[model samples]
Target: MTAKPPPDPAAPPRSPWPGSAATAPARPPEVTARRLVARSRIFRVEAMDLIFSNGAQRTFERILGGRDSVMVVPVLGAETLLLIREYAAGTDDYQLGFPKGIVDPGEDILTAAGRELREEVGYAARRLCDLQRVTLAPGYIQHGTRLVLAQDLYPSPAPGDEPEPLEVVPWPLTDLDGLLARPDFTEARSIAALFLARRYLQQAHQAPAADGKGRSAPGNASSPSPDETR
Candidate 1:
């Protein structure tokens, strides 16, 4: 009789999504909205006239598109991750997460990211990597979040006129696994960014040793170094 092979140790557990484990049947279209009724701030006051679909006349309240922002996944001291705790007026309480801010009109994404990093964390990064873009709430709000990987940080005097009172918090990066295990870490985009940034860092740390070509070590990309972009 032939012996059966053991299951692959690296295989992930079965779940609906890799990170989240909920499963539900696909939902049908809620309504075939053909025209917008109005557009206003705070989501309710309407202004512009609505345009209807040619064939099917459906209508929905016009929604104001939300602004875009950049969030930093800051790694410090080769072992710690930087987070911020601030009062969110919307939530009416203090919340903990990465440093982030809305992108101003006519501003570039990288510049905005750097500005937010410094304003919120009081540190500037020599190297900033574009990680990914995420839509925070597609169902209601239209906010977009651009994830950034910041490293080689140096202290900088914080901008005095920052809107919020942000407190910088640093915890060992190894505690990320424990943090994810907590229910408070359920912010989907933050969790995703945290996981992905850590993975990228690990990969970068394991890349071939820097040679004369001047490639950065894994988890360390070029910025102040060669073979890397700003």
Candidate 2:
């Protein structure tokens, strides 16, 4: 067989996942001007005039002024995850997803995550790991939500602003496919958080022990012993 052509150094880096090879510009576009376009009780829309490095100019409208939020994936024990079903005002239907809420002024992200967990699912996590920060739509939305993985959960209900009590659903962590197949679990942020949490748990399970033993780290609830797996 003929030798494959040399890779292009200027080409965008390839992603492990298919059809995801693209890179951001070396320099971001300059914002020439911005103006408030609309305002509602809960949302403000702003228009931005930008000039790209390539001399292309465009005006984009983005939602602004919302506080950054936190989404918590609460792992109960080693296998179960706690989810909540609540009425979604935008969709006009009840949806199932991880507990999430806006971070209050002067509140920490992890603290906000724990509070949302307690408010929505009646549980608090002793251990919380920040998984990632994700945006809804970078092209039009300036909103972001921090994904957090929570473990070592205990009951700790708190009053919340929900019009009705949320329904807590217990799901097996091993049955992530089953959860994904459900119609009600359609929130994109929640879906992304699920995979992020899973990847983190897997990495933690395979990490070397601190004592120099050839064993994995201990006390990770998500990791089952070899015997337990068998």
Candidate 3:
């Protein structure tokens, strides 16, 4: 039998997966010129002339917005999630998704999430966890939304600027598949938020409780588990 030779020390480490070698990112295209193409009450489009590193030129149009928004996944107890059904102007139909709103100027993300939760779902959360910041159609749109997970809720309804009252719906966390199958729950951002919140909750539940000695704490009959706080 032939013996295998030693590995090359000077060569780069091999990737565990075939054809999955990492490569350096390409240089971003430079903007040669930019001009406002259109403006509306809620949107502004800007046209840009770009020159790529390869000397290729292209004109791109992107939506410009300085403000970011927040979407809250309000966990109404251990298993329920508070969602909203509201008229989406873009679709001209009612869309089912988490409570969300634009973060007001000078307002923090968690605070905006809490406020939107109260306005849309008639509840305020004592605990808020930021899951992630996500963008929609980043190739054209410049808007971002911060996803938040809210818990320990209390009723605190507030008036909002909606054209009509939003219908609040409580969904079970375990029924995420059912929610995903609904046609009205097709918003990409909301779907991403749902998965992110689920992953976070699962990890939190699996984490061992620690004590002062950096050891797992003994389970107490009176103490609530992570599931109970969810």
Candidate 4:
């Protein structure tokens, strides 16, 4: 008898790639039942009873997610990157990062990206390109983040729920080393989006087909909108 091989990480996924395939393990554990263990204003903890294919059983805890979120990488100019300095309760300090917000119900990811750009960065993008979707702390968090590249921006502002106004910081993409050296630019999601966006822009710039039409880059395709499930 021959044993079946595990799924190949190098192989393309059946659906769009959401996270790093390198992190995926073969034969995912099936969740038998989920029971609410605790609830707070912002978080709901669920106790998950899971059974692996090999007959192993374990209990895991995860936070119940409400809605998807979008992180906007707005291009201020040929070399400029717009970031925001906002207060992070988890860190108990301010962090510098991109314009990001939750995707409200009934709105698609692209629209939500544009909305967040206006609300957080005081600008609305004429062309919004999709970069990728990222999951932060996927082992416990049920939510995912959609990264977007915003270009051809025009001044537009909207009211936001932030207790204090966010300080918009414009950094040059060429100075990534300097930005990374800063103590405040430490958000994992933001860091990933920045690098991905930079790579996409570089590819798009190299591609003759891009032609500054605001389309997505060649290989970095956008995932399905928030209205669709993976």
Best by lDDT: 2
Off by over 4 Å in 4: 1-26, 210-230
RMSD of each: 11.0, 8.2, 9.4, 7.3
Residues 192-219 of candidate 1: C-alpha lDDT, one tens digit per residue: 8898788777766655667856444554
Q: After superposition, how far is residue 173 of candidate 4 from its true place, in Å?
A: 0.9
lDDT (10s digit) by residue, model 2, range 89-125: 9999999999999999999888999899999999988
lDDT of each: 0.68, 0.84, 0.83, 0.83
| Greater-lDDT candidate between 1 and 2 | 2
lDDT per residue as tens, model 4, 171-230: 999999999999999999999988888877776665555446444343332623322221
Enumerate residue pairs that collide in model 1.
Answer: 204-218, 204-219, 205-218, 205-219
lDDT, candidate 4, at 198: 86
**Residue 97 error for model 3, in Å?**
0.3
> Residue 84 CA error for candidate 1 (Å)?
0.6
lDDT of 3: 0.83
Q: What TM-score do all the candidates reach, one by one?
A: 0.67, 0.82, 0.82, 0.82
Model 1 residue 161 CA deviation (Å) reads: 4.7
